[model samples]
Target: MAIDLLKRVDEIQAIGAVPKILETVAAMTGLGFVCIAHVTDDAWVTCAVLDRLAFGLKPGDELDVTTTLCEEVRDTARSVIIDHVAESTQYAGHHTPRIYGFQSYFSIPVFRADGRYFGTLCGLDPKPIKLSDPVTVSTLHLFAELISKQLDAENRQQAARSDLSSERETAELREQFIAVLGHDLRTPLGSIALGADLLALKVADPALLPVVERIRRSARRMASLVDDVMDFTRGRMGSGIRLNLRRHDSVHLTLEQVIDEMRGLHPERVIAASIPDLLCLDCDPERLAQLLSNLLANALVHGNAGTPVHIDARQQDGKFVLSVSNEGQDLAPEIIGQLFKPYWRAASRSGSEGLGLGLYIVDQIARAHGGKIDVTSSAGRTAFTFTLDNVRPVST
Candidate 1:
């Protein structure tokens, strides 16, 4: 139980919202001490703590189970609230309050999403205060639920990573887990994005706005990661990527929007896009736009900083061909084919810009549209081109 508890604590601590959640809990409760404790039959260990009173409890700190009130909460699988430890006739005889020397204390039992009793979200203050309020209880409960779901996500992700490494044995399980984690991530991510928006509008602290913006950016990156993983799972474990192909006369505009957005993100970089023939194609407009985005982003990430990336979408021989070209160190002849393979990262990529699935997803999108993607590198210039014929299928 302690091993699992420590693992879960590590998982939840990896999540970005944990710090905010603990801070908000302390602020809302007006308590000098708040903690998430992992309680077993014999030991109570702090998973996380916020101590304004110099309580000296860090993650993994252990306390005597008999000396902590959470032991009772764990045993009963219910919350314990003591508004005034000295005034409560029931608690006057209890040793925990006297041992801890706290006048007010509350603990809400926390459970895993699978309904296994896990721990407690508990807080205490030296002076007596009103603790049985509706808002406080509800907030703690909601935060507990959120923490549980976040822990579940982290556990799933960890398993997926493990399975990914031992590909031959656990590939199938990894695919299923990745699919589940990808879909399940959307709700909590949406909540975090919404919370960031609320912070932007409600909080006026000049220094804190950047932190909120970082949260918002991190959330967006997480959403992209989820999408990439989902695509890889579907393309690998199931059939190839299915598409909703449709004829669009204004597909050029969609590509333009993608370029504009990319430029806004990296304004100092130059990206030139031209679709002179007024693109009209029987393809998935959105997926085609995604392919272009992936290619352009790759170019920006690996291309020479002083050079401009060029993108051209053209109608040729009754087929739509889109090409992205960038000046960079020419990739070797051997490495070009692996660019579209799942999780294959080029050695030239300097940072963790992606899991190398961007190009793979782009390839899948192309194939879903009854098309093919190609790449060429020569004389320090690398270009990726995608082509779909006019005889596109109506549906997948």
Candidate 2:
């Protein structure tokens, strides 16, 4: 089947994990060059590449389909792994190895969910290395499968956007996304986190610790993105945020812990917290912690760094009131109105920091708790207060 090569390239890039996958493949297999290519009947195009051997191939770059083994994979629907091209009887005299001057090579076919061939996750190294280990081969194959599943997710998301006006279709799409995000996306991330933990335990080099930490951090960040998307899906699908509500006498302690954690994360910035001991109230402690974390993160990103963000949590007039305020430029009333909407970012702060669902999730949590978040911005001060009605505090 013919495919739009440009659109395919964009789809691969949008997965956000392709580059990391390529880099991880290279590191794992000791391959100098790794890439995810779009293989078709008459064309072989690089969709994403990690070039450590100066192979010089980049995204959108093309090579003659006849000269690449990926085309052979496309034809046979099988992977080709040659640990040592010079010693392998099957490919000793192959023209591809001779032309590309590679002693090690592998091309694993990636397929869509419906079994249609998409492309190959291929790598090559000039020096011969053991690439045929059962674990190594299986890991690479798993990576290819991850790409295929992510491609399905990207396609479904595009379709969902196109069918926004159709309520039934939108619900189905949300379910599809929830499944993909909950399983396909998070499964690999959990593996990455586990691998990082194992690597940290085994590696003794002090200099390599930071690299391990970075891997851990990236894994955490990706997991967080998955979580945000899942919450957003649940919130928008009209089910609302799920909560584990229970009575707690020391909810203030959880709020204080969240503030302390944020302070530790951003030592350069000041966070003024006043969380007094409060009587028992009914709420989801874990969900409230998540809510506070999201609010603090939002303030830290959009709030002024020079001034301290003030957080006050206490009972007020038979109601539970928790407020977070920061000194910053007053948000326009129009902008403030849209602050709780999903995927909304301010024009001045359009960056790749988050998926812009933090505030939206916060709003959902408030609603789930039979409360509402009110925003007030004036004279360089903005506060977000959550007030849950009919909070009759009981004695501990």
Candidate 3:
């Protein structure tokens, strides 16, 4: 009977005439009437009904949904039938027979596809009758199953819409963040460039030259931060940037270029570098140069003035480890974890010149090249180490 009702409900849903079909089913069953009631607040409300003999009852009627019969079906997780409403002890005080003039009632619990109870499909009659027919009971049960399937389908559609909304919100936030980054970086960068250009024209004051160089270095740092933000955005959007990889001397050429740039800007600070002569690696040269420049600049800005900043490169365990160390205050353990996160600055630093994107860019570059980067700091020294693929041949 349950399977048959489910099949009928499917047919009703396909036609989008469940109310008409339900009414027809009730009238034809000869049980005085039939009703499809939805459970709400432990009470039954008529959603659809079939009554042709002017029984005075209509659709959208409410009844005691929490009565013994309904509660019994729900609690026992099965169907219930009251053949004679007056004689049945369970239906004595129920409002069905007393108020609505219903003497015979048969109700099957409706369940969703996941087997959660949703409501009930019931048949009613004013005249006393026996509800012992197996075929009738089975049909009602089947109808309940059909209702469950429709409910399941609607729930799935709602969930899909919710997911789509969440995705749209995420995209909007990303766009807003990018817009703010562009706005913040433009003004400082322009000021730094203009200041450096003006300083280049004057040669009389030696002290002013150092200040001018600082402005230029700071401007370059801001530009690098902007680039990192753009790259990270591109990566998140699934448009992977193409790496311009080339064979280059890892230690000799790259470090020399980086050190030369830093030295030209920081003439007073001693920068020491030791790189092996013939070590070569396949990597994006521009990215490696930027990485080194960022590390060196960070050391100059944060490390103690006049203290030597050391750059070391060597092959260790079939990988090339490049390290930059300088004399600086030790960083707290908590700060180290967030060092590679964008826009995160250490508490010890002041004068927010860059967008804290240096270490983050280094991390991204290393990961893209199948490598890694890490740092160690103490009271007197801080070091950043990065690794790249060792493309050099092993000597016998």
Candidate 4:
């Protein structure tokens, strides 16, 4: 059951050269009516037409498939040509000529590029014409071939456009879905954190203090994961990480603050910092703090827990340079290359592992500031460095 008749008809009509083909065909063959028909197992529908004999058939018109000679053309995958139907031996008494009163007729089978039968390039007239001449037959074959090739090209282009549209729609839905989920989840997380704070103040038992702290930590981690997911979607969706850039007189203090916070979070781990005093820089302090925090968190998680993580921030040659390094087993070239990609993690997993978006977000922030993070892993130390040139110092 080949349904969707209109779609098939439109496909044929979309070929801009189809009308000219039909007109040229009718003129060369001396036929009063010529058309391109979409023939199927049980249907014969006109797709395009050049009618001169009051044939009363136009595009989208249909005829009983069983009553037309085109049906034989479709069945045989061969052309049916008749110069004088009434004088011919084969079709002289054929019911088709008497029913439609066409003395001269030709229906050349037109095939799709995939070798499936499509329909026919056909013409008809009341007066007999020299349609059996080899020159005329060959020219008609060429025209039919031209239409077949053109139809295939049009269909391919339409399919490509449709695929692109579908891909874009899927990407939009994915971004919207993740953005909404991240936003909706924050409200409950905030409530849990607030409740934990209230519990900590009221609970006097030493046994319950740790429980209250655990709840606070879990809520905060969940909130951080939500923020990472939202940022990931935004970065990939062509809107990079947002920033509020301004001159800060104590950018080095911002770096020190991040290190101090990380130390408080993991009091057991040792961290070493070397940042200059009164370092002035034009940058988004909060975003830089986040970038440094993510790097420190990643280092603390993956670096050798027994070794101290080192942070170095400085301003030299009118540029700000920051690097975080840890002593650990060397990472392979492949692993180092994929470290900045989102959701990428080494095979080993610890209970403290996050959603693996830290480095990816770090890279995004660096790029947003017109800088890039460089990685060098060898020996027993791995370092991630962020460099921003042309820095503007804060006014005195």
Best by lDDT: 4
lDDT (10s digit) by residue, model 4, range 343-387: 677776323445677899999999998999999889899999999
TM, every model: 0.58, 0.65, 0.48, 0.58
* Candidate 4 stretches greater than 4 Å from native: 1-162, 349-352, 394-396
- Candidate 2 lands at a TM-score of 0.65
Clashing residue pairs found in predicted model 2: none
- Clashes found in each candidate (C-alpha, N, C closer than 3 A): 0, 0, 11, 0
Off by over 4 Å in 3: 1-173, 176-222, 240-242, 394-396
Error of 3 at 104 (Å): 90
Which 10-residue window in model 3 sums to the lowest lDDT? 8-17
On TM-score, the leading prediction is 2
Q: List the residue pairs that clash in candidate 4.
A: none
Candidate 3 yields a Cα-based lDDT of 0.67
User: What is the per-residue lDDT of model 2 for residues 1-396, given as tens digits with 9 covering 90 to 100?
Assistant: 235998888989987556546655665566788899998889899999877778899889889999988988998999999999989998998899988999999999999989999999999999998789675677788778878877886777677766656646644564554546445656666777899999999999999999899778767766776687778767666777999888888888889889988887789999998888764679999889888999999888888889989998878688988899998999999999999987677896664356677899999999999999999999999999989989986655
Q: Is candidate 2 or candidate 4 better by lDDT?
A: 4
Query: Scored by Cα lDDT, where does model 2 land?
Result: 0.82
Residue range 214-323, candidate 3, lDDT tens digits: 55765565555456657756655666434787776554677788899889878999999988777777778788777888888888898989699999988756788889
Give the TM-score ranking, best first: 2, 4, 1, 3
